[model samples]
Target: MDPAAEGTTTISPQLAERAERSDLHTLGIEEEYLLVDAVEPRAVETVDEVIDQVPEQMRASVQHEYLRSQIEVASPPQLELSSLYDSMRVLRTTLADAAGRAGSRLVAVGVGPASGPNSRLVDNPRYHRMRERFGDLSPGQGSCGTHVHVSIPDDETGVQVLNHLRVWLPTLQAATANSPVFGGHETGYASWRSVMWERWPTVGPTPYLQSHEQYLTMIADLQASGAMLDEGMLYWYARLSASYPTVEIRMGDVMPTLDDAMLLAALARGLVATLVQEVHAGAVAPDVPHPLLMAAHWRAAKDGLEGTGIDLATREPRPAWRLLRQLVDYVRPELERHGDAELVTVLIDRLRTRGTGAARQRALLAKGTPVAGVVDWLARTTRGEM
Candidate 1:
């Protein structure tokens, strides 16, 4: 049956509820990207051109983001990691082919690697309204990243999961760090997104909360105080999504390839599952270090994996490799049980060596090629054409 064409009245609420409550592994990914042209250096305004050209099966998964130059592709809920790779590959190929037909290409990057004036690339009503309201706060119709969501059984579990997931988020951020340049200038920060996104009215790390009641109070206060326009503005480092029965982690940059994206998603699912089970069994896992979260995030934004991160337990800075070892040990049992042990090993190897996206971008720059060259590099990376 065609999913989009299916009438809303035909859907079963009970079945939907069961799907949300299921304890098995469930994962979803939303990846945002920059639309570029092989001959141009600025943001390429071409969503309509490519959308009109892609096949129907691929078009269903592809859509526009806040900006015209930005395209977001989200995978449907999946029970296994391999299925995610298949969907991602198909959508990416279709989009790339469509862009090619339009005399342009799609590049996945967290920030526009090169600078261009803020202008509408695609004409969408909500995007126009958002730009009008947010003013300069809106990165002005450019930049992109990957957001991962894993199902939670209930609100209580979601809140606790968000709180506990904080410490590991920086590591994930470091692992996927990709944005290094902005406006044609080499932003010293490995992930300048940390600076760019702060312009938004409500965004940043989730503060330490005592319990679920406290989390609710914080949200209510934000709404009342106007710090947030709505519940959507409570953009913590990681948070229980208001609309989805899942914990959403927005720490990572847009990965350049499907393999990296899937690896991160699988790891995220394993972490959430392991932690939720522990919480349900009345087992107290380790406490999150908000201070560590602050410092680690700083290092990730500054050095990617090239620099060391803070060890909250030891109160000292340690190399990313050392920190990653501790983290792998912490999550090894869960990875093994879920048949994702291979991915964990691959990620650990990457962590021990080069940094994630940011490192690759930096290397590409050192070669004396233009930022457009880097975009091309990322395209090849994601398409396995590298």
Candidate 2:
């Protein structure tokens, strides 16, 4: 019998069982950092050397990125927000110390502030193939980001969450906007990395999917198209994980501080949990138009939190903070369920008062600080020394 016709769906038994056992709002975080010359403060091709110095226990968690100057560290799935924060702090401190010992510094900025002609590709076959295929578009691909994964029951629920969560992704991007300066020039857009990243054909808001079968079919179609290299290259802002039973939110820039990264994770978890509960309660996913969603994403990328964001529901302009508050209210129940309500509130308040990382960088520049000073500040802030 057809699984869909039987109302059982196409989920594998293993996936269904794992989903049943999964803890809602369980978190996993992946952050990419750029290695820069300690004194000169420019992106340097030293990830290979720095990875060798990582502790043996963390070797598996730390991995190379597409660029030679970049390293990405991932945390095991975490159940508590505080534990996730602690794990990230340890990883950042360890990686920074290792990079410092190797005469480099790890900067968590979204894009390399001083990336120049010297940046090189990581010596990997896949990266080589990408460069060969993409040509000029592949050389200057050193942008970094923070990916947040929230556990869900199964692919069916995951697809539903993805559809419901699409409208709020722009708000998340605005909250974590950090990449203002790239290649030593003010890019005008707050998160310049967002602009750079969307150059890939598949890296944007996904279409509203009706089922797990539809999601898989879409991936299959994209892979069949020569535009995509593989299923792994489905770099949508949010998607069901290819290797894990979680919905991965990939819209935010690499936040400069551990606090910012944790804030993003908390919000992501809350959003996913809220959506799952709604699905259980028979709420249909919002049928928002794709172009409007893409426009919202573009507005968020261009303005960040400094300006207006497209209100997905109204399809009208609104203050970024106002939209952000709407998101918080929408997910407040989930936040409370996870004991993260107060923490998220406090973090959002702090972000408003201190401004985002991009705003902070602009403030330094406004005070007549050089680009190098901005880079130095980012390095110190990322290391928790500032």
Candidate 3:
């Protein structure tokens, strides 16, 4: 069955829960990009043309997103961290050149502009059904995001990992807030994409689930209730992959630079490894309440890295960056074990100096650079040209 095909009424078969844990954690990362007019900075319907220009060898890795103005690329799963970075850099450069040749620029933005005409749906059956069912929600569906897929041993392990991963969803959101400006004005929220994405009934930090049986039952219920048309529409922040033996952490907006993206990819892998280890040792995952997690998600979207985040431990506000640091410390040993320690350290420092993508865009606007300038800077940084 095609994962993207809509109208499946029942959940698909998956590996049994509680399979033996495999030590090796491979990584596969996907990033969705927006195609913008080269000069005016509005989203343009040129993804089909740009995709046509991709070299034959890389075609398998690239595909259309829900909107005509968006494209997505995924790296093949790999155990080596350094090689994965090189692979993504190549994809971005290749796609950027292809977009430029098609008279557009590839931007690593979260949400497309609200001022211009809405992006057209991708010319496909699945997308049309989505537009028909979701109504106004489809208009802003051009939002781009970075999805990290890390190998898991089995569905039961993946479900357990999802519970462990839920606590960090807000931290990931705060670090990757990139959609500050839409409609050529400040939206007052750092990751406006997160706000928009929540309109879907299934999208959120994954709920605390008891077993793999519950995971299957939940999807079946959602599908029967019309809240979801297929398993592909289960948009939890983290979930068991339907197509592969992996746990997918897909809560982040696309980062502005490759370094930012790699930092997130590294963190996702490290966190998963740490959690998996804990699971093997019979440790209980945190008993964080759903209400607190929801509040934390909202606060992170409001503040990004520049303001306060809810410390899950204390349920009180702390500097968002401090929370980010606490996360880094928590996963440092796992990162070291995965040989990602040195690279993550350098990337985090760069983030400290450069700030979140939303912050950089705001800084450009504060200097009297128009929205077009912000868009151009985003395009340049996306291709590592600056």
Between candidates 1 and 3, which one is better according to TM-score? 3
Candidate order by decreasing lDDT? 3, 2, 1
lDDT, model 1: 0.71
Q: Return whichever of 1 and 3 wins on lDDT.
A: 3
Off by over 4 Å in 1: 1-22, 121-125, 283-292, 350-354
Query: Tens digit of lDDT per residue, candidate 2, span 273-349?
Result: 99988888989878898889888988988888889999988889999989999999988988998889999989988
- Model 3, poorest ten-residue lDDT window? 6-15
Q: Of models 2 and 3, which has the larger lDDT?
A: 3
lDDT of candidate 1 over 1-386, digit per residue (tens): 01111111121355455555654756778787777776776777787787888887566677766666777777776666777778778778778878789777778777877767774635655445555666757564476767787878888877777666776777777767788888787898888877687677666677766677888898898778766655655667688766567787877788877767887887788888878887788764356555666777888778776777766666678786566667667777877766778876875575455457778888878989788788778777756586
For candidate 2, the clash count comes to 0
Each prediction's number of clashing residue pairs: 3, 0, 1
After TM-score superposition, the amount by which residue 119's alpha carbon in candidate 1 deviates from its true location, in angstroms, is 3.1
Clashing pairs in 3: 17-156
- Candidate 2 error regions (>4 Å): 1-23
